[model samples]
Target: MSLDTAALVTKLTEILGPSGIIAETAAMGAYLNEPRKRFHVPALAVVLPKSVAEVQALARFAFENGTPLIPQGGNTGLVGAQVPLKGNEVIVSLARLNGLREINADAGHMTVEAGMILEEAHKIAEAEGAMFPLWIASQGSARIGGVLSSNAGGVNVLAYGNARELCLGVEAVLADGRLYNGLNALKKDNTGYDLKDLLIGAEGTLGIITAATLKLFPLPAGYETAIVNLSSPEKALELFYAMRERAGTRLNAFELVPWIGLDIQTRHGMLDKDPTAGPSPWYALVEVSQPKGAEGGLLQAGLEAAFEANLIDNAVVAESLADRTRMWAFREQMSECQSREGASIKHDVSVPIAAIPRLIAEGSAAAQALVAGIRPVPFGHMGDGNIHFNFSPPVGADDKAFMAGAEPMHDAVYEVVLKLGGSVSAEHGIGQLKTELLKRVKDPVALEMMRAIKQALDPKDILNPGKMLS
Candidate 1:
């Protein structure tokens, strides 16, 4: 436990071999850097474990030596969960553990190693005539481990559910290097407790997840995508409920986007053309999936009903694959487009589906009141109520000054969200950035139970220290 820096690196190198160990700070840039570029503390070392056994060994070593180990995947997490918090922590990278263990398309499940890229998992499932429907922006670089660990919620969460719901079971290495092989694809099990759910969203605080059994769905025949023009969030909510009543699970995504987002993207040349039907106050990018041999045009039918009821102003249903891609491009490029304007204050908060309108309205009003003209760009999965309530700086405003008001902006939005019975950290885990906020907002008994669980699972506090629960 008292080993010096050289001795620590040498010990890790011996366990993982030289090529697997990143001993120097300069070479650890990829693992050190995160999506938001927020937390930048240097690590003692970065150890890449090639196999589950190697992961167990590394965990055992870190546990016995009392070395703070940060469990990292693709390092694509927006929060600081996948990166280091304390300078003395060593990053245990699962990059080398990339492998697909098993696939059973007939049973609607597949077992994949933690290090497998989410996009690759998608491709693998597609090759077998199935689909893993968790579609996040970072799927290209985000690995399975980090996706499950962070309990990622993406566009398709309205239907297929989040990473936790898509996941059947997890195979992990506990703090004491005990391999908990609970990977199963069963639909029903009256087990003692749901440990898979626990470790999946623990953000590596409970254990180091090595592999997982993920649920798969039959490939949809086609996806009907439409960008509907909305006058306000209230209309969008009404439209969402109507679609849900009609399509039910086929209604996959209901995303809300502000017209200013379109203006920002068009002004910045990020898009070739405006993807919406035309300019409106707000837009809802609604999509429904048609399964094989099932009826098509469900989304069209629903939209026609909405039109009859005078819900939306105008809309554009994607006619071809290219149109679909372009429509999605407009929605996916929201976060990037905001950066093109200036500094942006973002909150991944959620409200009740009914309360979404109030959350955006009051949150925007409160933000503008705190700092005049702070453009509110609240958008995301409206079906599930998780909105990325973000604010862009006004034209020609100072970035530093806008960011200086970030705390109050966050306070304002979270106040609205909490008042409406919503989660402050909707999809993103409480990493180093929101640890204090979680401490403040979370119930004391829940906090105590979480602390007790963390103590029971990771007694040494070596697994992802200073993350989630701090």
Candidate 2:
């Protein structure tokens, strides 16, 4: 039998004390308000579980009562996975479970509780002469569980890889209140079906990630960074291949930015000074890591070669740490800078690496055809083939009307992406936002496999219900 709302709240409070439960609406804002502010469904209560045992207990209770449980960490997700969909679900937050279980510098691995913030993990790694390569813009507020759950990919994915690649193993609590202890430091295991992989990007539908063993690497001596001018995405691609051949694995990042990004930032006075060398249709931010015994200037040499080949127009190499930071700030602030322009329609999609140029070209034309004066701002990880294809409404257009027309704009861009053999979601996984799209776009057999896994792991559909799967 289903319990009444009052009984459920009272039982949750009884199990986790008054401090652990957030029952008041005003106090629940921190948990309810996700990063995008798109999902506004109110949760029944927010439960702060401080330990693995607490998490297991909470899971068991929710499973037995047939109440939906949304596993949340940091609440910094762009997708609505960490927030409630149905109004009656309870949010089980892992923030209070923050703990650093162990760090082995020699072994190059750190076992950390899921609640630890991503930036804090970086600090711990730095202290040990190691580096954790997974980076996102919201690292300060994003926790390890949410990062691993979403399989986040940041700018450095060109060199290191995404969260799935960085994680060695994970420990999670299953829907039936059973703990799946899979954490280990092993680099290679030819064993079974890779359950850790399943839970890592499952978005909490299969299990609640409690802790993880993450791979680490020796800290680079420094970075050779530069921002180069490119006439088009095709030129950027040529330059990327040249740098890859020269730097090999040292090529850390290759990010593409359109001129509109520079214009918006400068017009809004968001930057102290222009970070680019001069005017160009597009800019490519490139970086190569220098090991302890290795020399720098690899980026400069590559850029010089590109210029000689007529692939790039000009470049500005960062001479000091401050210059490097400022150049990175310009790239990292792309998403936030769009807000100053007006209402924006954004899509995170990826094509084959070679098809990036075509994807951008075709996508831009389609979006422009739909809205006469729309400004296409296609930018992001060119090396990884992922583009943050965004469009700013015409100058002085009504925000309401422009936003109301977002559906056609989205359809236009997605159609192009689909034609290019690209994903509807590149880095950001499907939350409630794209569940329907996933059903329509994903392969039928693949969808069946996903459904079977969801049923086997979470039969009652109590964990993060209506997330990755519709």
- Lowest lDDT sum, 10 consecutive residues, model 1, at 270-279
Tell me the lDDT of model 1 at 399: 98
Error of 1 at 52 (Å): 1.0
What lDDT score belongs to each candidate, Candidate 1 first?
A: 0.91, 0.92
Candidate 1 lDDT tens digits, 310-416? 99999999999999999999999999999998899999998889999899889999998998877889898998999999999887899998899899888888888
My TM-score estimates for the predictions, one after another, are: 0.99, 0.99
Q: What are the clashing pairs of model 2?
A: none
Q: What's the CA error at residue 186 for candidate 1, in Å?
A: 1.1
Q: Put down candidate 2 lDDT per residue, 396-443, tens digits, no spaces.
A: 899999999988888888998999899999999998988998998999
Error of 2 at 76 (Å): 1.4
Report per-prediction Cα RMSD to one decimal.
0.8, 0.9
The TM-score of predicted model 2 comes to 0.99
